[model samples]
Target: MKKLLIPFKISLLTVLFCVCLTNAGQRRLGTSAANGLVIQQIILKGKVLSAVNNEPLAGATVRTEIASIKTDQKGNFTVITKKNKGTFTVTYLGYQTKEIQHDISTSQYYTIKLDPQQNTLDETVVIAYGQTTKRFNTGSVGRVTAAEISRQSVANPIAALQGRISGVEITQQSGRTGANFNVLIRGRSSIANGNEPLYLIDGVPWLSAGISKASSVGSQSPFNSINPSDIESVEVLKDADATAIFGSRGANGVILISTKKGKQGKTEVGLNAYTGISQVGHTMPLMNTQEYIEMRAQAFVNDKISPTSVNAPDLTLYDQQRYTNWKKNLIGNTAHLSDLQLNLSGGSDKTQFRISGAYRMEENVYPGDEADKRASAQLNLDHRSENEKFRISFTSSFSDYKNNILPTDLTEGIYTAPNLLPYEDNGSLSWSENGSAVYNNPLAATLRSYRTKTQNLVSNLNANYSITKHIAIRLNAGYTTIATDEANVYPLSSFIPNNSRISGESTFANSDFNSWIVEPQLTYNRSFGDHKLEMLLGSSWQEEKSSGRVIFAVRLQTKLDTLG
Candidate 1:
């Protein structure tokens, strides 16, 4: 063993010395290879132009299957890929994208153009329970395509639809973790209860409207928990003519979500992954230690009270130490998030299937905070006859979420007047011990936060039986269930020290929501040259039920009692 060790150490030192010398030589040469091997290489050349105007379109994107680049001043970009035998997709915002297959080694340059989308005379729109041509439809309708859904980083499906079109509003209550996200479409049309839009997935009514938000004070919605990556397209039904079928929830607008399905093709796999960091971009200013202490001292002198009267050892000392920079500790500076998705889709003329799975992890910028994680699975299957007149399809999904974090408000209280330290030995206040005033340590509280886990299962089935060449009747049914268990532990130190400090609150909250809906519709289609006519009428029944319970330990023996 000693002989082996001696040779290993000598070999390691020799390799390190060589590496150092190699690095030094590279630095001196600036752009020279240590050996004959060419290590780094970049081949960049491409052209992007507007198909409509035939002019160069700068800032366009040229993306290969695994790499991407943005066009520069001359509307050209260069991306590196192995073998150069793949397809390149060029895209520009507000324009139709183009994809071309070519051998890269043969042609390192490209002249790519993106065409402007042309709106046809007759556009089909999905209404309350069916689809109709926009020109002939007398109702109000809004449609969002798959391309639009891919443009933004949305936390929920609804957020994907917000602000992209007119007459839609989304409001986030606060910047706290698991904050409430409220969405109102076409303004508020109801006086009592909620004015949230009704949701439909694939043609069957879904029960997301009943999902409430998280609230520190009251009940709120968790609509933002829905993953946007799972959606293919969204259609909103706005006016009475478009919403009459959903009379009960029609006061608000209706949003229809369609999940991706398999198309007729060979089995293929698609993967998408993105990782990024986020942080609080801004914050309100608050007084620091010296400013706080000085301001309090002045306030006392102005109020004609003895500044000495504020001498609470624990409160004063803690306030002095904590007030140094409360905001820094209160707000999380940086957070990381990563999402991965895998999809397999394929089908023949008669049958098709799609399966997809995704995992996401998000770390809050705040310290001692537990990261949030979610996993989702989806499956879609469709079958059609050779005549293409009859088709049947099924979709299913499952998802789970886990989150743990503390409230930010509690962090700010450490320096508040309630816990302000008044007594000072020389320039610093004296620290307090066991009998100190009750105030949560921001960092401790953040680290000691609670945990919540939720799981959801969904299934949808639909079929289209064409009665004629241009006429058909469709039937669809869907079921969705969500089960959530959230637990919170409030440590004794978070409360006033005393019997109250001995009191602890540890509660487990769980709820289950289920919804089932079925719809049958008849449609007629005809086209006379440029003129087209299509109609549909359908009815559906949807039911949703949910219940929850919370258990807590009201008795606490010490500040650490809730730790368990």
Candidate 2:
């Protein structure tokens, strides 16, 4: 028994010694592994830039599994990590996020270039009464950027929207410069009301003057008053989801125009001017003297009438050998256009401002005293409190337009007989002969005095206050005034007969439109665990007044014109 007990004790001691040795070895291995990890940890530095323009991208984010950092204004960033090899992601707005598996232990500095995302799903878009991202939009909205608008030089801002937008049809009523155009979105929907889309310039509805259709006198487009160069973007809302916010005004469609605003940066002064000439695209081929004689003779034969009959008196007028291209004589071959705009913009951390002045002159294709001239000025200001809880903005614009219009149908001059001379041998306008059809001289029709002047003032003021991170209130007030005056004069020389009862005719018209609007809104936005909720409650009050008067007179005596 004593021998067995001694062997058991010895075995137990040996087992205990072996366990202690194993534990010691394990401790040593753990220490060495900890030391290795310390050596692998490193600091990595990089600079980020835009791949397209190679511009430095500030505020870019760099993240690792255990750490994160942001790039400075100089586009430089640094991060610390605990692994020699790990994946790092770099992200920036409007750009694709990039991931890189790099051995931080090997390199200290890296130059990273990020590419812009081609998909516009993340792009921000302006909606009615607010702003939203394309991803959140539930309606079909077309957007035109300033870059696209700047590519084309157009007389009217609406002209820049042609062919660029879907479901929109823009037709120029006439070839004359500054003429009104017919803009139909999703085709015409109203038969009694105007089919023109509602135009909103900087959140204020524009009071468009005149009819959308062209008249015998001329066509006037209020859109011409706006300078295209000053526009920053244009948004067209076609579907119900986009247009419903506008209520009744959006029955046809809605057009939102955003003007250029000051940026939070250094002052920028821009000067843009362009000069060009426009000519008649095509000329109508008319019958010359010989062609007219042949055509008249054929007409007589077709009517079964003898050319020698005295019924067709004064046939010698058609016997003239001279020929004239009436189109060239009435509608000038070319027109001149000139536009100049000057703008200055700048801002600080709390305030920003942009002011601009523009002038445009466009000569019509008509030869005599037909042209359009416009002068405009705009001022925009924005202010924000240091806490970023309170904000205010003001926008004001004024424009004056003068149009010298031709009073007659341009196509009529094209069909006149080439043998008919406008001036007689004594330099007097040749009236219709005793036995001939009465025809007024085309040159005299163009020389008649007709003019229209329009003046517009648009102003808006907005204020916003934030009660908390999730609640805010906004107020918008706007006023617009438009006045137009038109006058027409026909001189005694334009009359057919010297003893005409109406020696001269004159007409004058004046119209004024005034509108004011106020809107107050309360917005609440909150987010919870990957879910976001937003609610908006708003109400608007608006008023519009219009008044006009027209005066007409047929002067039996020239001195009666002085009575006015």
Candidate 3:
């Protein structure tokens, strides 16, 4: 056994020695082969330009299998590759991405022109948690651009979206200014759940479009605080794709609003002003005074009842010769709407800024001096580090809005008695005939108004850092607060004196909604030949605190009512 083991060990040592010699020779041979097989590489110089204007497309991405780079301000790029023939992929925002193959060994200089994307399907759309083109989006998305919105004479941006999107219903809840809106995507989602879609302003959640439903008529829309002219685009994300990103909040859908930002151009100032009048159209066809009286007499005759002061006041007690057009006097006034805006914007490609202020006012058709007035200001600041890897953007909007209008709709006034006057000889609301309670004063509701004042602030900050060519980190932080002070008043003059001692009262409500959110995300993107891959890992943290109070008082002076 010892002799056999010694022979086996010697055989193993000899095998190992021979293997070492063979590996050394192979290494030497590989070195010589590599030196001889080395390919001669050439540098390619190119320029990327716009096909329409021939303008230089700065920061355009130029990529090849061997090398990749971005164009300089003059749209020039250099690529070094060993292949004598290869393809180059050129891409820029708002332009069609193209791949052009060239003979690199024959020509060192090439000019590539990219055409602007003309199809709406190719236009980029901002979506939930990300952005993509409609042609490539996996979910249903509807987009409205700033140009389309600017052409519309609308006070709320949501109104401009009407009739523009498919399967989306946008309706005004009330005719009054600052009234809430109802938006449904693809009809109702559930039988007993809130159907309002989640709204995001610059990626920050908008808790609600209004503060509270304290008004007896309709809820005021907080969307009014966001000026329509200041918006750059509005994107609606619909279906399960949206719910996956926002959980149940986006069960109905998602709305993304991106405000305007400054561009790289000469400093410019713009002023916009518009004034118009609106009146109720097409009054209901109704019987005149003679027709109404005749109909009433015939009805009494058919019922075998005699007309009395208590039963037929229109025939016995009130003035028989007096005839009033109830609809005209109640809602015949023309409403005046006016808007004035001033904006200043200018900056370089690295940093840009835009600031604007606007004033808007809209009067109601009611008899009183009731109107909705809003003053708003917006600011947008954007910056990019010299390396173009670290980028930061800040957007903020502020507005002070006041609504002085009736709490409930005055449609009831249109069907009032056609022969009765709205006012008495003493210039007061007519409610009594011969010192007796007989009828109601439709104009009285106008005296009892619902007044509200709201101050809204929405601000956001976004930052992104590139960890590598295919990996990036992004942080989104935002803060928003809405302060609303609303009042519902009922003066004794607005009500009839019943039971000899009736009183009037008022209700005051104040609310504050404050919230903040922070989100950090890590993303990876890489292209492998014809296929592309992307990955994202993110976390979101949000906090909110709210408080409100309501108070009731009797005989409060309307002029002295102040929430401040």
- Residue 217's C-alpha lDDT in candidate 2? 48
Write model 2 residue lDDT over 432-538, tens digit each, in one string.
65456666677777546878888989888999999999999999899988888888777777677654354778778888888899999999999999999989999
Put the candidates in lDDT order, highest first. 3, 2, 1
Model 3 agreement with the true structure over 1-564: per-residue lDDT tens digits = 998999999999999999788766655443213454744555778999999999999999988776789999999998766567877799999899999888954787989999998888878898866778877888888889999999998888999999999989998888777788889998998877778888889988886555654674678887977799999999988887678868988888988999999877789999999999988898779887888889999999999999987888887776666778766776778899999999999999899999999999999886667888999999999999999999999999999999887757787778776777678888888886754346887878877868899898999999999989999999999999999998898888888756543569888999998989999999999999988898889999999898999898874334344432
Q: Identify the runs in model 2 with alpha carbons over 4 angstroms from their true place.
A: 1-108, 111-119, 209-216, 307-316, 433-437, 556-564
C-alpha lDDT (0 to 100) for residue 331 of candidate 2: 75
In Å, residue 167's CA in model 3 sits off its true spot by: 1.8
Error of 3 at 386 (Å): 1.6
Q: How much does candidate 1 score in TM-score?
A: 0.69
TM of each candidate vs. truth: 0.69, 0.77, 0.77
For candidate 3, the lDDT comes to 0.85
Q: Which stretches of candidate 3 lie over 4 Å from their true place?
A: 1-114, 302-304, 434-437, 555-564
Best by lDDT: 3
